[model samples]
Target: MTGSVRAAHTALALTNGLLIDGTGAEPIRAASVQVDSEGAITYAGPDSLAPEVASGTTTVNVGGNAILPGFFDCHVHFCLPGGAADIGLTMALPASLKVFQIAERMRTTLEAGVTSARDLMGVDVGFRMAIDAGVIAGPRLVLSVGIVSSTGGHGDMTQLSGINVLPYLQSPGCFPAVADGEDQVRAMTRRILQAGADVVKIAATGGVLTPTDRPDDVGMSVAEIRAVVEEARSRRGGVHVAAHAQGRRGIQNALDGGVDSIEHGYDLTTEQRAQMVDEGTFLVPTLSEVMGSLDPSAGPVALAKKALWQGKARTNFPAAVAAGVKIAAGTDAGAAPEHGHNLRELGLLVDNGLTSMQAIVAATRHSAELCQLDHLVGTLEAGKRADIVVSDGNPLSNIQLLGDPANILLVIKDGVVAKDRAGFLTDRPVSPR
Candidate 1:
């Protein structure tokens, strides 16, 4: 082919691919996708009806590969390393080292076919800006800067310290803050927004990761949660709050407080599930975290937690599905098994009672809706960004293909091909770390 022919500025067409658009519809066979110079999909369907590719256009022969919308990881931490607690006293490492660690995590995430990620906590606004400016090779980011919690609550870093230490000398980073009362909660929420958070995250319940609190304990009061919701709404951005709830009362409080989504509904009751469906509240089960905790090799704490909670998750999952609760996918990446292996969440969802299609939707369209980014990403359709992933085999037949990056032949983000079988090649190279 001539150099001019190879250097196209117009449409880039992928022909003869099996298309799964992430809309819960049946797959389309022998399809083609035409992307314009502006990165919008101009046409997608049968190759026979695809718009003509003018001169100097690029073409890719998909050879019957399965093309689907890129995956989204709803719960991730871009600024914090995955095993932060494991680092112990090394947590005192300079901020720059933390930044580089995050950069590497982003690259690994993208390489694994996650084109977009919603960082639930511990990501600064500066990190988001860096990714947006193409200074880092990371997924599109929706970040919650830090978490707000009551004194000694799930996010209270103070709990991790020894009793001999003076609390006044402590200066917390992005992990969590100990705020109390409605006014304090409101102030903290605004502070997070002002600090560049896309959404405000609050610990409505105790957590498994933190040393002191029980996962079932209600950590934040209804007034505190409401203060955050009200303040966030006044900004017109409509803040989305992710509640790390694991108990019935905590779930109730989260729903009543106008939390957009409940993360890890480990202890929610049938009544609470029905209420969630009735109130239009979304649930993100984060099945992979449960599964990871069950792995005997994952260590005693994780294994013990899983042994205690797995039965609860098993009991709750089918009930939530039966109750018609809107479930989304999130793995709590960075908590265990790291960031890049997010797709393991999908398989775990399916294993936990979700049909393969439902699990896929939870990770894509449902996740986008939860993140309020459905208009920009999610389903593959005309006028949407050309963020696509092509796999060597049918992912529906075996979701495990998603867990391994090698099975993904292509990954495109914003109409730019970020990864091919040959490896990373782009006009603008964003350093991984």
Candidate 2:
């Protein structure tokens, strides 16, 4: 998302394309969009009826390409490297070097057509600030900053032998909060909000990635979970709370405790889906990581953990969809293939019964709502931020094309051409296809 394409346009018009708009509506054929200098959409609709572009506007004929809102990943861990769980090695990386790796991965994410990312863990406030200030070309970042876990919980990162290794790992401005009581949860919730977390992630249950825990083990009590959620609500900007819960009881406790969303709800049941729908708790199935965890190559412990939960996830996801649960897209990007392959999640969702268009909506408008950025992005509607992706094929017809970044011809963020592989797109107007 750099080079000459970065700031190639302020007033821009991309016309004669198929626009999905991210609204779950049918694609508008012969579509167009006009973006103003402020990076807001001035017009979006049929190309024949598009408003005139401002004087000096840069117009590019899209040549019948398929345009859609930039994708969104509601869960990610950019600082955690792929395919390994050596806390000692990870903690030993110098802070400066870790930041460099995070920044570099962010660039790859942006070019992959992910314009907005909600980092659930392992990213610090500094990275968010640097991305916002344009110090690095990356997606707009939403940060949870640190994870909150009970002692001996999934995020504890402490091993047997009483090593107390959890304290040794820290991301510049990020650190986990280990608390056991309601008082500790309340106090730590305030501290995390004070630390500039846009959201809060509570490990309400043991997770697959941890060494000594079963996925069905509920970690935090309902009272403790309620404390964190209620305290986070009291903070300014109404910070969101996402619960990492996999067990049935844990998922129910997190929902009752007021978590805004549930991440990797591996063992959630049909009854739970009904409750989630009633409670309006969005579910982010990080299916990519679940798929990877079952890859056999992720090692015995990882594979064993996933073995207990994958069956339920494989079955429960479609049930959740059938029950009309609010579902968003997330890949758990750091779990496998690291960055640059988030689009694979859409294909996974489709494999689990979501139509290509439904999966696209899950990644677009729905994911935006989960990230608390629906007003700013997620759709190519007038007055929204001009974050759009142009793909070589009509993804509604061949959704798998997105799994390959080369099919992504262009990526525009805030009216700037962040990526443009389309040789025909230039400052001057061109003939329609």
Candidate 3:
């Protein structure tokens, strides 16, 4: 194509492709997309019905690739891999090294076709902004600086060994803002919001990473959770909160406290699931982490975590689906199987109860709605950002193709070709060789 045709202002037509609009609508074959200079899609339909193209606009022939809205991961930690216990080693590295590691992971994730992600519990807002400004290549990140937890709770980094031990090393973002009373909780919530967090993350119960506490033990009192929620609302932020809930009581407490979504909900009761439906709360089941623990090659800590919570997750997932509770996909990457392998969560969701389409919806549209970004990038609709992905085969029939980055032939972000089969638009080499 000529330079004028390749970089035009009117529309870039992508013809001869199958389009899944991310609205749970039936797929349309031989479709074309018309994107404008601002990155908003202006048209999408059968090629025969497509609007007239401008003279100098480009037309790409996809050759029958499957085009769909890019995937969204709701819960992720951008930190480099090391077990929960080894996070201390990351803290010992220079700040520059840590930033480099985070950037590398971001590139890997973006190249995997995840165009957007939510940082569940990390203080990487600077890194998030860097990606957005084109200083780096990565998904659009909605970040939550470290989570808030009670002393000795899931987010707490204090080590216990018969006698109270000194504080061990912890990653900058790993240390929870430990609060006790309701007043303290409210203050901490305000502090996090001021730090540029897009949402609030709270540990309502103990977690698998913390060896001492049981997953069922409720960490924060009802008063404390409510206090934090009220504080978040007072800022006019609509600050969504995700609770790391496991036990029945903890799940109930989080729901009653007005949490937007429940992270694990492992061991959740039938009554709790019903209440979730009534309250319009979303359930984010990170099943990939649970399944990873079953692997013999997994670390002892990961295996222990899976052993403790897998049965609960497996039992409750189907129940939540049956109850009509809104389910959003999350993999809790970096906790077990590591980041960039988020698509495997779809298989676990399918094995649980959701149909193939339902599972895919959970990862795309539902996840965007959960993050309150549906207006921006969830679906391939008019006036929405052109964040699209093209895979070699139809993902609706075989979701496993998503797990192989090579299968993703094209990744377009904000009207720019971030990744093509040839390479990234930037000078940097393509990953996943």
Best by lDDT: 2
TM-score of 1: 0.90
Give residue 201's error in model 1 in angstroms.
1.0
The digit string of per-residue lDDT tens for model 3 on 204-226 reads: 99877666887888988888999
Query: What global local distance difference test value does model 1 have?
Result: 0.76
| Ranking, lDDT, top scorer first | 2, 3, 1
TM-score of 2: 0.94
What value does the lDDT take at residue 144 in candidate 2?
Answer: 83
Go through the candidates in order and give the C-alpha RMSD of each one to the true structure: 5.2, 2.3, 4.5
RMSD of 3: 4.5
Tell me the whole-model lDDT of each prediction, alpha carbons only: 0.76, 0.83, 0.77
TM-scores, one per candidate: 0.90, 0.94, 0.90
**Tens digit per residue, CA lDDT, model 2, 281-321:** 99999888886645565688777667767778898888888
Give the Å shift of residue 186 in candidate 2: 0.7
Error of 1 at 212 (Å): 1.0
Worst 10 residues of 1 by lDDT: 1-10
Candidate 3 global lDDT? 0.77
